[model samples]
Target: MLNLSESINKTLNNFAENTEMMWNFADDATDVLLGDLDTEIASTPYEIVYQQDRVKLKYYKSEAPVKMKTPLLVVYALINRETMLDLQPGRSVVKTFLDNGIDLYMIDWGYPTRKDRYMTIDDHVNGYMDDVVNYILKREKVPQVNLMGICMGGTFCVMYSALHADKVKNLVTTVAPTNFDTDQGLLHSWMKSVDVDRMMDTLGNMPGDLMNFGFLLLNPARLMIDKYQSFLENMNSRDFVENFVRMEKWIFDSPDVPGETFREFIKDFYQGNKLINSQMELGGKRVDLKNLTMPLLNIYGKFDHLVPPGACELLTSRVGSTDVQDVCIDTGHIGIYVSSKCQREFAPKICSWLGERDGNFSEPEVSSPVKKKTSKAKPAALQN
Candidate 1:
């Protein structure tokens, strides 16, 4: 009887061990599969135009009715690909604006090569961006274009608006960092300690991988470990899996920032806080934020780690636009665009806001609703 009992115990232990092994194997397989899916979803369509030196413009197009009110120009930060706006058909901010009868153009600061190490903030804000705006204005035969900027791109737009306010009919900035002095965020604080010159000297051109890694490090526990574990728990559902993969691809699709530009950004804006202080200079011209008198819409993510609400809110008070309005969404940085909840709420709000200002009377028809496809999903507040 004792011998029989020992054999049965051994068999039960083996079964438990096999179950644990299988679970681990399944987890690994799920990870590999999700990684592959992310690559496929992020490869959305885009067109490239006017490549010169290391700068290129990439954009997405949609059909528009003739006599569209104002041409919309979107400027995205150089730290990542501009495709984040048009992430997918149903989930795209670009598509939403186009569907609303707005003519759209986006700036794609193509990945900087090693030789582009000398490109400065002036080159982007005052030189290349100015040329692009003029080109669009001349081609479209419009008196002015509506300007939108995202993150660092917002900084560029603000500078451009100060210099060429007459060229823009209205100005919009989303998740833009204007006042680096606000203590509500940690990113600017960290930037204060970085020796940008030494770093630029070492790297030549600031590598995208390095910038991406730093962002991930800011929320290492959540981005690195928790996010994947949650994905593992929901791998069986394909739709959830696809959306997850697409966002992953967007997050990782970083671009190299020019060294001189990065250096100036870190020193002038982050360290010196010169832009808001009215001491900032670009291309031998002072960047006077008070000169921004065009109708301004400043949108920011309330929980954004990169550009905190406090950092972004200073513009409403500083800019000369008496019509300035601030919209603080209950979101984090990327959530301003991606979160499924945002698609339903934030996008509609933006569409309405823009439509009202442009004299567009037609209501936006809701595209096919994208179901909450992800399983084991975290709340939008937590995910962002």
Candidate 2:
């Protein structure tokens, strides 16, 4: 019996050693395969429609152009490029909206340069955003425009709508953070504790790479390790490999945020929790949530690590809009916009929601010539 036990132990040790060796070999092979896939994926053709500053606005054109009942403007976060909306032909939010007869205009907050170091939230929300909105109003000859804000862009859109209620008909916010007090979001907690002044002083412009690294750290086991393993197992499949590569390109293609904007964002929004509290101010004007009276649709993700349901739900209570609805989709932060599952459920839901509200949509009437006021009302700050 002793001899039999010894033999079994030896066999088990040999098996364990062999398994380790196979794992090492597989890891090496996966590295090489992924490297190749990355190169191929980065080369995929993406058609971006408009360019403002360093920002690129990519859209998937509809096969048949249908005149949308409402002209919609989409504002994406400045942290990353806006390609996530139009990731691919079939899996595109913009395409889905366009196909559903929504005329879309997305803001590309372009790459911030050294000169843009002092660019504040006001600049984005008031300056550039105002210009874009006015341009759309003029081009379409519309009185009021529908505004859609995603993530941080949603926060900006909310502010913009509040300050310029006359310019906006309806507002839609997807995965936008309004309450930073929620503990469910790891990113918000980190931002709350961060010394924005020191960080900005240390780095004139907040490095995009650093922000990307933080996002990766949020789900290291999944994003950094498990994803690679899955890629290797499915490397032989061309479609899978191609899709993987495209996602990787979109993931790594991050843009640097301006320093002043970063400083105010951390202090005012994340740390102070000002937006919901109505303590936030932009360009010397207080950002009162009560000022937002237009119809509002707040879309949130149930499992979003970045902007949890709690963070987004706060908007419904804070905003003065009587006609407000909250939609909670079962998806993660990025998955809400890009994943195949969300593409079917999330995108279509937005289209339907907007369509239902189309009755409220009205074009801005041409103003009759009048004596100009001594001073025009100051535009809201441009920061999204």
Candidate 3:
């Protein structure tokens, strides 16, 4: 409808504006990508209450008045640092629990070295975990404490709770793979073909980067391709860039898993699929899911590829606890713990669950799991 000259001028002006907009985006992106931004994680203030070998117990002293009788011990997986729980100020799981008047304690399984290659599930569960629980109980002067675990730590908690139900007032596990018979996860499929014996013998410890790459392979398009693309697309935003970098740091900060421990977990849990059936063993003792008779809360991510719902949901049906509950969060593995959307639900749910269970304990038994006698404990060998 316009004259030829007018139409041409209009088209040129539109093109010039588009070009300028892209240039502005590029400049802002450069600033975001290169500019200084704080990426520090686990910045919540805590005192190291107990230390033995590479492991240290972090007791988060809260300013808020305490309401619960039992102090909580947070056990994280050996694969990564527990810092994920306390990544930043507002997003910190530790802060959330503290703000809610829950006394909290966490285990920092520090980095592992070559000498840790021979450590096994027995050592972790019976040696370090038991000792840690003993330390917390002794320090807090409580007979039993609430124990919460994530991923591998959850598996350990299950094992511990099954063996020592009297020590744990309530049990909580998030995104923990229990029944590993399904084709719901890439790790399940790939681990079937893996030569864990050769890998452990040759490498001593499984590299964190290698394990991380395997996780990335689970969804190449989303994790490998699209995530970076999204970052690039939103690189101009300082907050976005800072959050992205923080996650990246956490993801890559994995520690080499101890060789024997890796071998046992891969063979026993991943390959043999023993935990659900009450067939796994640790430290000359048997690990029976039926032995987990404490008040149980099994939490899992619905979209968790690493540990599908099939892997987690079976725990409630299998465990011996009468007061068992399964909380299926509507998010992925990491997002269930740290996503802004999940932040309001996740910690509050856990705190409420624990608060309800705090005053409602079964009749007191003469023997308790958390009351193990420890005159002086030695250092555990491996790091996280």
The root-mean-square deviation over C-alpha atoms between each candidate and the true structure, in angstroms, is 6.0, 11.1, 9.7
Evaluation by TM-score, superior candidate among 1 and 2: 1
Q: Which stretches of candidate 2 lie over 4 Å from their true place?
A: 1-52, 55-66, 360-384
Ranking by TM-score: 3, 1, 2
lDDT of each: 0.78, 0.77, 0.83
Counted clashes in each candidate structure: 0, 16, 2
- The segments of candidate 3 whose C-alpha lies over 4 angstroms from its true place after superposition are 1-16, 360-384
TM-scores of all candidate predictions against the true structure: 0.85, 0.81, 0.89
Q: Model 3: clashing residue pairs?
A: 109-384, 167-370
Most lDDT-accurate candidate: 3
Q: Write the per-residue lDDT of candidate 2 for residues 2-87, one digit (tens) a residue.
A: 59889999989989989987677677657656665433321223355556676554433334344556688899998887778876
Over 4 Å off, model 1: 1-49, 64-67, 370-384
Clashing residue pairs, candidate 1?
A: none
Q: What TM-score would you give candidate 1 relative to the actual structure?
A: 0.85
